[model samples]
Target: MKTPLSPKSTSGLRGEYAGAGDDFTVEQDWQSYSPEAHDRWRRLYAAQSALAARYAAPQFLEGLAKLDSAGGIPRFDDANRVLQAETRWTLVAVPGFIPDAVFFDHLAHRRFPVTRWLREEHELDYLVEPDVFHDFFGHVPMLLDPRIADFLEMYGRAGEKAMAMGALDMLARIYWYTIEFGLVREEGGLKVFGAGIVSSAGETVYAIEDEAVLRLPFDPERVMRTAYSIDNFQQNYFVLDSLDQLIGSLVGLDFGPIYERWRHEQPLPAGQLQAGETPFKAVRLESLGERTP
Candidate 1:
């Protein structure tokens, strides 16, 4: 997902991924955004919020409301003010996609890099890169919860460790399947919690209501080792017993040895679901019962 940095700009930040001929860093002019962009943000915000109430996890709703999500294209400063006061998480603006090392560094320090741009109207429902709406709407609201915030910090620490171990691929799968496309079993039925799912109107319903997608139980080792695709609706979605169960399992586990063992192993494709082989089950998150470790 890395892109060559655009030509050097007067921005203070230096480019990390600029190609040999170019410097990547550029100053983001957040205020210069057009009225059309604001409309796009407002449209997206209103539409998604309506859908999310039905499909999104309850906590997501509460946090979204608490953040006053109705405002169009939130200003990082204003959003950060609220986020900082509530959970100490702040958003940093980045040009576009950043290197994994840089991304990990930001997360480790409780800074989430949000792109300052919004997608065009035609690009609605799908975009290859993370934008302001996706970053703030898709990801930020969850940060309001204490347990979820701690899990994110721990995840950042884990990312740093994984990078040192040369296991970024394995580590990314854990993020993709859990943070981006995860589901949780609720009394009503399966519900959406992953940002990736929340931001997509079609995928939101598909992930939660569709019988086609394979739903699997959450396992740290299995999740870390699994391979996922970003190009399509996930073929497999991992369901957690609860936020507490997910945090407890991963916040304490050592990924170094696990990554070492799984590095050379063949990765399972995004959609492979087998009852005995893949641990794909229909059990509710509450049904996980007691902790294993």
Candidate 2:
């Protein structure tokens, strides 16, 4: 859900404006996708899938297997059949980014908004905005996990509270650090579960193997108080012991007091560690030894 706090003007962005309804949803028009678009998806999937197998969490790998999206850009209707059965979630198509309120409402009800259009050929390596590949290939598999599924619904429900309290920035940080760019400690070593990392081959390896990055244990208050960068690879990534820990940290927890204290305070810089904070030890990639290709 890479949405803006307020709706940006999309007057000239015909890709995002055409056929959108009051709610900003549009028909996926699955058949209209060119063969080239499907080919692009195939290439993106093949490259990322190999990287993911070596560095992704078991839960993510399981979900990816269930998705069976290797062949082409999946029809949302077809993917929904598996998603609805697995987690009672559905994917809705939108032209591009929508307003935060609209985004929260969709998540609150277990509907995910995926962009209807694909990026052009030249933009394959990188794109500033989220496109269909980033939304579906990056995120949808994780939605198959029950913990993640329930956690997101709760996050969506909490949106109004964050907005009313003028704490949307803090909440967005939570989403950015966890859903979009989180890491987790599995039995083998540190592995990525974040969509943002798993979707990019470069980061999929960089996040774990790069000793220069800062990895810290997940802390709700610390996460909310931290700032992040969008233009490049993250300087800091939060690590979860388990998905259960992630859910337990926020379930029925009050954020009012936390927000009141930090809302007026300057956010901690992205890469700088606070005094007394310890960084998680980097995982040794060489020790992993011969992963399946």
Clashing pairs in 1: none
lDDT by residue for model 2 (121-170), tens: 99888777788898888899999999999988988988999989999899
Q: Candidate 1, after superposition: displacement of residue 204 in Å?
A: 0.3
Off by over 4 Å in 1: 1-28, 275-293
Question: For each candidate, how many residue pairs have backbone atoms clashing (under 3 Å)?
Answer: 0, 0
Instruction: Report the CA-based lDDT of candidate 2 relative to the real structure.
Output: 0.87
- Per-candidate local distance difference test: 0.74, 0.87
Model 2, residue 180: displacement in angstroms?
Answer: 0.3
Model 2, 287: alpha-carbon shift in Å? 2.3
Q: Which stretches of candidate 2 lie over 4 Å from their true place?
A: 4-8, 11-14, 291-293
